[model samples]
Target: LPWHTTGKLSTNRVTSSCSRRAMPELLQFKDASSMRKYSRLQRQAGKRIALVPTMGYLHAGHMSLVQAATDRADIVIASIYVNPTQFSRNEDFGVYPKAREEDHRKLLAAGCAAVFEPASLYHPGTVSSDGAGDNANVVGAGEHVVGAHETFIQVEQLQKGLCGVSRPHFFRGVATIVAKLFNIVEPDVAVFGKKDYQQWRVICRMVRDLDFDVEVVGVATGREEDGMAMSSRNALLTPDNRQRAVCISQALKWAEEQISHREATPSGIQHEVTDRISTGGGRVDYVSVTDAENLQELKHFVSGQEVLVAVAAFFGSVRLIDNVVSVKQAG
Candidate 1:
């Protein structure tokens, strides 16, 4: 159940299993019920498989995850499900960018072996429904309820900082859907982007704590030439907002420079960074410094513990988040 692999797996069981008369053939499934069949096959072969989960509208960030899988796995399966639970009612769940057909083409281009794009597979409750998983009144259950109704994965202390403060249920929704996807897909490894630094860390912890038989790998955030991190939501930005939204990344860069030089305290770094984002005519939502892995608010920066500088802001009506983690610099 340890997150870190010894890389020297016990092959006795593996050898015995392969020696069985008939190992199940590998197959991919899209819906939740079909997952059992795939799970059975994976258990039979003990072969490596990987999953890359995304909301669709593939960008370099996603493609990077796919390529990472190709490097680490014998088979790569990407699931494109715009997780409805991950979105708040007012948070553009209905209109979040989805390009299923385009995503299929992109995954194909990226050399992914297969993709499971589940559509409208969730239970819809009422507007008054509390965001609890136990809500009894299942009003209109979508065809993909198994895909939709996930037992939420909550990693304690990891969700204490960052956008979790404002978007209270965001990570809960994320954790639930991701836990389900992780369970349904049952990949040997799963990939996530470092751009969502907190989410990535939370998921990493969830994998370790829940004893999920999956390795969580984080690919560095893919970015534009001008240094802004790429996001599918970037498409929503108007030209002027797009130009000014660079302030978020720019601020994070400036803060990272200060931290590297020992020139700024966390508070000072955050204030200056938030001010910079705001000065660019964007409305700052939150700018925080936290323990890099756990996303806990930082009281002091210790030598071994990494630091995370994260910010979210509104560029026009669209809210965007960008962050920098204290990754070791190349020599």
Candidate 2:
């Protein structure tokens, strides 16, 4: 039911107009050999472009970012690559959603100027640290071999806790791919969703530290009426488990209330949140309070350092995460 548009349109009607736009033509690339072929078209268009990268299986959360990109730039290019490098052997990489044809239709329907539905590994002209190609393994030349690890970027410190703690290699893989995307897309601005608050913070810090000319903008997380954040993985939820997913967001709200009412200390808040979710039959991943800026745990809250309560839980095979932060939270 949620709809939005990119570029200039009446605030009330952007989504509708975006829908009216034609379904985007697919820009498929076999490998890094094709990056030039695609970027060339972007350059020829002579318009500022924006990038919104995601794992595909588009939902309103991603659409929100795409629409924001369209609002800021003349063109929007969304990448739906589920980079294999980013996932560990035991992670959700195997189960990650891949709705290729459907996603292409969604991207076109979202009013994006181009869809970088790269076929597989993109050379980016940057070889892996091990001096091998990333796509070599996936391409399967018939002899049976694993491809090389292309050069990937890593951002330190900022990724210590939050989602980073659970997914050890997550930010490193994210930074690497994001860096690759920036280099490849070369957009004037890029969009990221604020739902994965830690991911946004990591990318922002990377852009600043790396001195990437592109601007990084964050769109708010899109939510269901029940307050569950929209995610493709949400489809994996059972009807009953789907209802518990809302508890992640609800517990976040309850924590916000605790802080707003000043009733729970950081420890008290953590305890209460974990108790609430666990009692509700949710498998708590990690619940903690931290300094909003540095992501360091707070034994107690300071006057205004900004505090965030973040949680991740398993709902069947899907892991749902939700966070609540102080009004002026730092990071």
Candidate 3:
């Protein structure tokens, strides 16, 4: 394995296997400049690169993204930076679960070619410490300082509803960091899990509108056997809260069913989902029925048009989100 930290590169050997062939050593890069240079070299060699950007708590959901990227390109680079800009002042950035060595092991086993683990994309010359806990002082949405990163990217219309309504600063941070990754990695394609439906749509719209020459691929959301969507925050759930969290997926499925049968209005479905989650011991953040493509909240269902039923709820302080898309059929 090769680890690039503070613009210095060190190599180590790791044995791994992939479906295509015996995998090469896993490489790690901690700085933007080194990764950019490596990406340029790969591009010059006529290799197709795919990027799977993650926050570094590797779970099955993230590995699915890596597999999706591996299937598409010759080289797969997974970036494991827990973006500080995305977190709000009161958010869980400080306590965000991090397992760097374990994450590296999983990516190595999944046959990822390289890991871009930049410490501070916004602050030049800032190096990452061993864990996310040490980087607690990294600036977030409103915590700007003199000579700190001030620029942010926002997809105006798409980021207005759903999760945006609650975590207003979130999508801007996501869009900005992702744009920086697209520029740094310059991958031929990028993979994102569709669990965050609004975020996926936001990134797609950003790529299209900004004219970034990268293909954005959305993989289906990975779920647990009990129907709960996989998330890093799931680790924070108490035993009781974990059980309660399943209602999010259950509500989404019920909403999808209602849409398919045309048995309820969009508002009716939203209210029902919210009530179900609340009854299940979770605090309802929002339940929205919106146009799947544009994310405009829908008041009436249109046959043959896809609408998304998305929800975000708090299960004992751990917020979980899940969504489902369905199209009504003409009678």
Candidate 4:
């Protein structure tokens, strides 16, 4: 639990001396049009709004983004939609962890003003008026619902490689939903975690190329005390695999040290990392270094060049990813 507050309590607005301070009202909206109307009102009133888009099952990493939002804006709206498009047919879309009640509590505790939770933004037909299913799509005029949304935004160049190699449809889903959120929220700023480094870069480029008048800020990745990158999937790791999973981050740290203090070849470093995680009982997906900005694979390290050493592996059915970004400084 990342329960943290930055500013002091307002002395002017007092409810009771013994009573604890009240949490912000957590408004929930299932319609994008309603959310847009609320946001429009906020903007008209001279209030600056910050948007933190997320799939539910909130964690410290997500909370950190909300904290960043509150730090910058007058009000913060957190969108919690488990995007179905981002998950392929074989992926864990159906089984992905969800904690609606707990997530609501956490967001309210974290000072989030409201939560935008539509049943299906892409495919509106998946959800019914009774609210019994998984989908939440936005219906258009004539009450005719789109069965499955095909029109989507794509960040062409940035989505070519890296995680894109494995999860082909991931970035397309991400960009499309995020663009929708930006339009609906009409936020002045949006905060994204850098743990998904490629996703963050792709979104930054999308905003620039598409002319969305929203400033996208990439916040540093939040980590656990043990150094493993915090993710929703961590809970699925078996006890033994959970302990061994530390090797993913350890490999990145080891590679960073070798690059910084000793002469290191990209291939040599990758081989060692692959061996380290493999011997630890993890099935390697990819262990490679690439140019940070373009995500082009690197052959060797050069001074003044920035690179990201990223790794993804599976321990059982759960897949994990971690990375260490290094810049070889120029003299």
Q: Whose TM-score is greatest here?
A: 3
Worst 10 residues of 2 by lDDT: 7-16
Worst 10 residues of 4 by lDDT: 8-17
**lDDT by candidate, in order shown:** 0.72, 0.72, 0.84, 0.80
Give the per-residue lDDT digits (tens) of candidate 3, residues 12-91.
33445553573457777777877888887778888899999999888999999999999999889999888877777678
lDDT of 2 by residue, 224-313 (tens): 999888888898889999987788888889888766556457888898889888877788889978876567888866555578788888
Colliding residue pairs in candidate 2: 7-70, 7-71, 24-108, 32-123, 128-150, 128-151
lDDT of 4 at 164: 85
Following a full C-alpha superposition, what root-mean-square deviation does model 1 have from the true structure? 9.4
Q: For this target, which candidate reaches the highest lDDT against the unseen true structure?
A: 3
Worst 10 residues of 1 by lDDT: 7-16
lDDT of 4 by residue, 92-196 (tens): 676778898888778877878778888777644643535524332221112334463558889998897878888888899899999999988899999998888
TM-scores of the models, in the given order?
A: 0.81, 0.81, 0.90, 0.86
lDDT, candidate 1, 1-331, per-residue tens? 1111132321111111333584322223456755544544555666588889888888888999999998998767788777765665567555578776667667766766556666544554333334544222122223323334445556667776688887776777778778888777788889999999889988888888888988999999999988999999998889999999998888999888766655456778788998999998899989998777667677656654577899999998788988987742332
* Cα displacement (Å) at residue 111, model 3: 2.0
- Full ranking by lDDT: 3, 4, 1, 2
Clashing pairs in 3: 1-12, 1-13
